[model samples]
Target: MTASHELRLITLYAICARLFFITLIVSASLLPPFDSSHKTILPAADPRSLFDVFVGSLLRWDEFYFADASRNGYQYEHEWAFFPGPSWARRLVRSVWSTGGRRTISSLSEALFTGALTNCLTVWSARILYLISVECTGSASVARISALLSLLPSSPAVIFHVGYTEPLFNLCSYMGMLNCMNAKWAQASFYFMLANSFRSNGVLLAGFFLWGLIADPFLRKQKIPLLNCLKSILYAAITIAPFVYHQFTAWVTFCQDDGLSVEWCKRFPPLIYSHVQATYWNVGFLRYWTPSQIPNFLICSPPLLLLFWSSTDVISRLFRSHTQSGLAKQASMVLPHMVPHAIHAFVLTSWILVAAHTQIILRLASSMPFLYWSAARLILEQPKLGAWWVGWSVTWGCISSILWAVFLPPA
Candidate 1:
């Protein structure tokens, strides 16, 4: 809060941001060269392998199906069955890029570009998270610490450098959170929608915004008029429209292909479905048997534990101060707003646990920014304890990173 403190925080943020960028550049340089021979026509029936399947789906879009009938002269199927609209857009982009006679960038270049974009988004998201904490708690220290923790060089940074979707999702989610806190409902809805499109987990933004609106003292005092609320809801609906369109297209394609209604459950084999069902039934099951999967489980467990512990502390604090000062009254007034955001976080976390395959570690890493912010706040309240806690977290994070790199499978 002091001038000196503000200066120190700003300095810390700048240094961290610079270091993050440097780390990204160095890591990208260490990656293997992109295989030029890997390039081929869109949708090669059985497409060389899984990596090809993913690249073709991402870059060519028209190759997202299993049939070859739709392919005009291409060896692979042009079945634009699932999410056809996006495929058309992708095709257009590729056509234009080709016509320009620009050499196709290698896969390594593509990966690096994506990684750079993701890291930039991560920085932006960290700033937004910092802003939200400042707005909600009115503590500059909280904001600074939250931003720093969000950028920790662990799973999040690693995922960003690998062309994963987590960084982009984090950016949109945090932007939505910031907009919601500021009572910019339309903007919040737009960002939330973008986040959801990238990953279904982004629907959590809707819940977070709703809570912020209801809890905000200004909004509660008629800052958000009925007309504004209606407009916000409409904006949210518009944003969600694309997802609806995608699902509809997918369904129509499926129906046309099968000549009958498609059953979602029947799509997956019975054995795999049964395994997933069992996992869902057992919340704390340690039944992962694969050597590769064990590390993932270990990496994911610490964050869940931290989330649980922080939630308990928050609840306890809320109750302990319930009968005291005007702060209590303010908190009581705000509790309703907090409820929805809390619930949304819980739902998103649970969904990650249940729906995720072995990749749950990476999937849930996006939520670490928010969770770490919460944990940081709890620790900040107790100076000595906070210092100890942060020290341990940093130490463990470093150890984990080294162990992960050492055990990583050879490329």
Candidate 2:
């Protein structure tokens, strides 16, 4: 009906769905964790009461580091793997919450605070994603469908987890993308800067600045003004400044005097993020291609395939002379504005497939609106596959939530 009504509906749906997911996830704690050691993963994971299931159990996986960062500043070298943005948000919220700052997030008050913060971020992120989808597709119906699909994201566990980056990162990324679609370059840059502070790959968001300012104009053979060129340079620099500064901070921490003992410090440029990833997480080109990891790859295929196909669909439309009906018609209506996002999806999908942790695409892909939009396209034009995708999202989302609560694999 009306925009306000639509927003109200979205907010209500998000809240209901999130609560439902949280209910199932927390209830799953009745089952013992996959590993006995999970009891010690977080002090809160000790089966004391329902509060532990609801809040404490969420502090699994990378969240341990985040809880540490929020409670205590980055204390270890590997802690740099997590950007401080989400932790900073947690700190700000916890501070204003005016309680539970005495120790680690094991306290019930702190755990509740974490859930509230992440839930708010996620619900609002869905709202912003709807706005961005409408801007991109030029149809509220498409936007509505996409936003609903976003609610069934591939990793509800991680997205809803306490102290996880997905919630904050998705919100900032969508806000920035929405601003970009509205031609608000400054707003977009500021949000992009925030997104970069949460995830290192957020540097890739500079594509929007580059495409809007330089690449898109060049592709269309439109004359770019000198002022525009200067603005593009400035905006791009601003967008990537967080990532660059993150690297700089790492250098200062580990390189200046820590070099003699650290192998990564001696390397030219000395980026500790890369070193930490490769050394600690075994992240590199083809490194995860072993037999033991095939299941992980299988686990991550749907989003990666969606990203790959959707990105190619957009690029192919750019080259095709006409659009076909039904599925092709729905997919081939390429808005020039969407090109940069498609390119981003393609590049990121490629990177994750070969180099980064493939399984992360579940949660990582959530930050990209393109995935949801693509899923919407399938629902409209290719119902069978879309149904499968929806099934996968819901089934996997519930399972992963329990897996996360129990400190299971696919971390």
Candidate 3:
């Protein structure tokens, strides 16, 4: 089938599958949660109404924080852990649907409005990812397969049904990569900046700008030009501007009022994101390596392993000659364009493993299209293992939706 045909089919499948998954989660949310006593800002007790069952089902765990931020700005220090992109985006989207004269009326609830925005963004992201895969792999078949596999993400709840950052993040990240592939450096930097506004790790996306405008030419034995060097720095800085601005805002808000009283403000380059993650979430290097968190480690291992394997498989093949006519010859497919993405996945996976919350890889992994490529590769080369991967994604995605509804661990 053509790419357009595949996108239409994917759109249908995504809607149906997302509805099914939400049905299960909402059904479970109708029941009492597994633990009604979640620490750190979870709403106590079960959702009390039909509307609550639908919206509140997905609003468990950290979503409570997002819901709060949607109604209110970043008033609390811990609320700074979440970027303002989703909240701000939701407000913009809701305004489009607002009615009654001066457009002061909200036609929808916060959860409903956010879901409408994300549902469209996610389906559109699927198509963008398909195009990017085609650009990266030079094969419609690989792109189609990768796009299909991406529908069954390890964290379906975050992608389709929630007020989470990842849906917008995925769209922007894919757009940035696609723009970079097309040599649209300015547009690429803009999209990456939008991505960083959603997730703090989005600052790492500047590597794509650096790689495309700078590193790629150096690797090809081209003499470096001063113009390219200046362009690379400018674009990469644009991509990272959101993160730097985010920290600067926090400093302005907190440090100005209390200054040295805030412990994080006392340090050099006092970033509230880093401080909150470390102090509130215990997310420093090896801080999450406790025996009590073993289950979370196991839960997140599949994607982590897949990500590492995918990057290393491409990177290792870089050193080998591909003139021989066999698998070795095929190993170098789109190697140059993929170099940045593979490195991105590898470095980001390592960062998640060592320093960040390991379980978050399930949600964050979807932002990197390379993960789907790796899964596609497995299905093509090792059908048995790929079947297992598919089974695990479907099964665990359903289970996680339930866990989210009930407010269980691995948050």
Candidate 4:
């Protein structure tokens, strides 16, 4: 079959899988959320109309933070922890959809619209993932499998459909990688900038692209002008400048309010997000050594191990390809293009070990494209297991979704 035909098939499969997953996600909202007697959890939006079932279900957990940030800027210090991209995107959408009126859109309406909008973007993101897999492996079947793998409703799966930053971040990240693969460095830099603005992980993603530009002969061999290179650098620098601004903001805010000296404020910077996380969220580097953190790590290890294995192969091939001549060198670079996934997975794992909550690893793992790619490679190698894999994955997704809907441990 032609590549276009194969791509069409993959697109159709992705659409169907997304519809199925979304249906379950919306339906799951009908099930009552687990009682939160002791935990200081945010209250979910009340499902007033039919639309609530679709959007209301996703307003739990960190959704509140994003919603609050969007409605009221970074009024509270803890609110700065959010990157603001997702919330800003939602506010933009709400503004465009709103008719001229004195009253602003209700927070409920804003949250609902944000959830629906992000979820729709996720469908397109899956299409991009399929395209990337096809570009890398040149196997339509692998592409299909990779796209299907994205449908699994892991613990943080709801984040994609909610007001959280993951959907926007994931979309921009995938687009950046796609542009990078096509050697559209400026475009890739732009998307990466947006991705970086959405989440702190974008910094690591920028580094990953830098690695590609430096290590890949194909990229370096391009006879680009100095001006273009400088442009790329400018875009990248602007992307990272936000974090620096946040740090500066923290210092100014603290010094003005606490009556501290400029010198003392410089030491604090604007790392209030980090401080809040450490003090309130109990997050610190290498902080997951406690017995309670064991389950979170164990549950997420399978995908992380797969990611590590995939990354190791890339690192090995990166070296091996350097020694080869002609086409062999190019082929080796193809595998190493996936090295970013490994780096992302590594960062998340390291964060889990040292600083953040262990459960977050589950959500973060969904960002690793190699996890899906590696799964596709395994299933395609043993074609007989394909159906079984789908069945098991869907079954697991259903159980996890149910548990997550009830606010229970799902990893």
* Best by the TM-score measure: 2
User: Cα miss at 41, model 2 (Å)?
Assistant: 8.6
Best-first order by lDDT: 2, 3, 4, 1
Q: Looking at model 4, which ten-residue stretch has the lowest summed lDDT?
A: 36-45
On TM-score, the stronger of 1 and 4 is: 4
Give candidate 1's total backbone clashes.
0
- For each candidate, what is the lDDT? 0.49, 0.80, 0.79, 0.66
> Candidate 3 — what's its lDDT?
0.79
Candidate 4 residue spans exceeding 4 A from truth: 2-8, 35-55, 99-103, 153-155, 218-232, 257-270, 324-327, 330-336, 340-348, 382-392, 409-411
Write model 4 residue lDDT over 1-411, tens digit each, in one string. Answer: 776776576567656765666677777767776754212322454455556556556656666677667767778756767776766686787677675764676666676677667767777777788888877777777777787787663335666666677777888888887887787877887888888778876776665545555444454465555565565566567657656666666666776855454343445343666766766767776776788768777766656565666666665565566666432454522464565565666666666656777666567666666667877766766565545545655776676666656667652
For model 1, the superposed segments whose C-alpha errors exceed 4 Å read 1-101, 153-156, 213-232, 257-262, 265-298, 312-340, 353-362, 382-411
For model 3, state the Cα shift of residue 85 in Å. Answer: 0.7
Runs off by more than 4 Å, candidate 2: 35-48, 98-106, 321-332
Error of 1 at 238 (Å): 3.8
Candidate 1: tens digits of C-alpha lDDT, residues 38-121? 234432524445444333322211122311222222232122212232233334434554586787544434534544555566
Q: Better model by lDDT, 3 or 4?
A: 3
Please give the range of 10 consecutive residues that has the lowest summed lDDT in model 1: 60-69
TM-score of 2: 0.92
TM-score of each: 0.64, 0.92, 0.91, 0.83
Give RMSD to native, each candidate: 8.3, 3.4, 3.4, 4.1
lDDT of 2 by residue, 243-279 (tens): 7888898788777754658888888778888988998
